[model samples]
Target: MSAHIHAQNKTTEMERNVLLIEEQGSFAVGGKRIVKDGNFDLTNPLQPDGQTYHGDHAYVFYQVPPKARKYPLFFLHGAGQSKKTWETTADGREGFQNIFLRKGFGVYLLDQPRRGEAGRSTVEETIKATPDEQFWFTQFRIGNYPDYFPNVQFPKDEASLAQFYRQMTPNTGAFDGKVITDAVSQLFDKIGEGILVTHSQGGGPGWFTAIKNDKVKAVVAYEPYSSFVFPEGELPEPIQSTGLFGALKGVEIPLSDFEKLTKIPIVVYYGDNIAKEPTQVWNKDHWRSGLEMARLWAKAVNKHGGDATVIHLPEIGIHGNTHFPFSDLNNREVADHLAAWLREKSLD
Candidate 1:
C-alpha cells in the first residue's frame, strides 16, 4: 500500500494544485488563506460520572469554519498520542490538514480514551473490572519481543526508528485500550455527525465510534489495526497476543454486526517505503501492522459489499518521497505532495 516518487512532475502537480485550491479562496494572500476565526474550544461536555473527572474528559475543535460543510471529519488519536500528531507525525510524511480546513469540514480532535488522563483511573478501569466485560479489552499480546510488554513499551532498538513510539499508559494496558473507544463513542454522540480519520489501534475504537453515529459520511483509516478482522472470523495468530486482543478472543462487537451503521463510505490506507514495491519485505517487517491491517480492511469491506481501496502510501507519497522524510532533504517535496493530496481528495 505504498509507492515512492521523484521530485519532477509530482512537485509541479502538487504546487499547481495547491495554488489552484488557494486561488479558490478569493481572500487568500501569500499562498495562505485568511482563515475566518475558528474559535472552537476544548471542553468537557460529558460530566464526571463513574470514570471521568471534571476536566479529564475534553475535545479540541480544529479549523471549524463559520459555515459548516455537508461532511466534516472527527479524528481520534491512538494511545499516548495527541491530535497534533496528525499535523506533525504519522508517516512522517506530510498530509492533508490544509485542504480539509479550506473545504469547510469541521474537524474535532477528540481525546480518545487514553492514559495520562483521569478517564483511565475512573472510567476505563472501572468498566473493564466488571464481570460483564471481562474479555472486552484483554485480547492481544506482544509477540516475539517480550521487552515490549506490559504492552506499552516501544521497541527497544527496532533496527532504526523513523518515528518515536508514542508514550505508554501508566500501568494497565486494559484501560489504555478501552478508554479511547469509550471516549470516541461518546464524542460521536456529542458531535452529531461527521467523517472519521483514524489510524493504528484507534481503528477498533474508531470503528465503534463511526457506527454509533449515522451522520458520519465516510471514514478514512490509516493502516487501521485489525481492520482485516471485520468480516468476522478468527483473529490472526500472531496478533492475538496484544493487550487489546479481546475482539479476537470473541469479547466485543464485530464489524459484521455494525454493517448497517456505516451510513456512508469507508476507505483504508497503509504506508510503504519509497524504495521497494508493495508488500516488499522491508515494509512487511518494519510496518507489518499497517500493511496487514490494510489487507484485513480489504476483506472486511468486501464481506459487507463495502467499497474500499488500498493505496500504496509510497505511491501516494507526500512530494514523491518515502519513509517519513521530514528530517531528510526531501521534506519540501513531501509537504507539497501532501498539500496537493488533500486538495485532490477535497479532504484535510
Candidate 2:
C-alpha cells in the first residue's frame, strides 16, 4: 500500500471488551458487551491512520481533578504492546488511570507510530515474520521479577495467545522522538506543564524526543530501551542482531546530542530488578543499550543542572521487566511511588 493511503487508514477501535472468568464471566470493549467465555483482541493493536512502525502519532487525553481541569501527562506503552497495556487492570495493580490520576496528573496516553493499531505491518516486516506466523512470546520471566513485566496471560479471556503480533518496528527508525515531543509541547502549552512518562520500548523514543523539545519539562521513563554504550569499540550486542547490524552501523548519535537538544527537567525509572550484565547479554542484553541511554541522559541532565534524576524501584524487583514496567506483582507500589515522585517534581 502507498504511504499516503496507509497513513490515512489508521483505525480507532475503542470497544469495551468483556473478559469471561475462567469459571464464568465476561468483558467489554468501550462499553460493548463481550460474551462470557468468548475471546477477542480487546486492543485493535494497529493505528487507525495506517501509519506503521513508529510512523503514526496522536494525542490521548485524560482530565485530572478540579472539575474538568487537565494536567496533561503523556502515557506510553512498551514495545510489542499497545497503550492498552497501560490501561488493562491486572490482578493487583491499577492501570495508569489510578496511578497517575490519583496523583493529580491528567493522563495523555500515546499510540506510538507502529505500536497498537499503528504498528501492525511495520513490526511484522521488521522481524521478517510471516503475518500468520505465531510470534513466540515468553512470559516466564515474570515469575522472576515484577508483575508489570508482560505479566498478563496471552490470548486472554479465552482468545488465542498468538492473536497478538510482534512489531517489526526498528528501535531507531528515521522517526525521531521529535514527532512526539512536538505533540506534547503543544499539549503542555494548552494543558500546562505535566509529567511525561514512558514504559519499555516507549522509553527510548521518549528520551530521543524529550531531549529535542523544551516543552516536555519532565519525564518518568520506566526502563526505556537503552541504546547506549559500545564495548570498548566493539558494537553493543543488540545492535549486532540479525536485524540491527546494518541499521545501527555508522550511526552514533551520542546522548550528549540529546542533552544539547532538550535541557528540560526529567527522571528515569530504571528496573533495578532487571540486570544488564554481559553474561546475560544474549537475551537480556537490551539493558546494555538502556543503561547506556540512561548514562547519556544522566550526563546531559547533570550538566544542565538538577534537571533530571534516575530512580530505581527495587521492591518492583529485577527480573525480565524490560518491555513492560508496571507489571511486577508489587508494581502498584512502584506506580504509587512514581506518582508521589511526580507530585514533587515541578515540570515548570
lDDT of each: 0.44, 0.46
lDDT of 2: 0.46
lDDT of 1: 0.44
**lDDT tens readout by residue for model 1, 244-334:** 2322322235655557433446666543331232332222343444454455556655656765566655556433222223222344444
The digit string of per-residue lDDT tens for model 2 on 52-91 reads 2233344353544332223457777665555666664434
Error of 2 at 65 (Å): 2.7
Could you estimate the TM-score for every candidate?
Answer: 0.54, 0.58
Q: Candidate 1, residue 198: CA error in Å?
A: 0.7
Number of clashes found in candidate 2: 48
| Model 2 / residue 231 / CA error / Å | 19
- List candidate 1 segments past 4 Å from native: 1-58, 88-99, 115-120, 123-176, 233-258, 261-263, 274-283, 315-348
Clashes of each: 24, 48
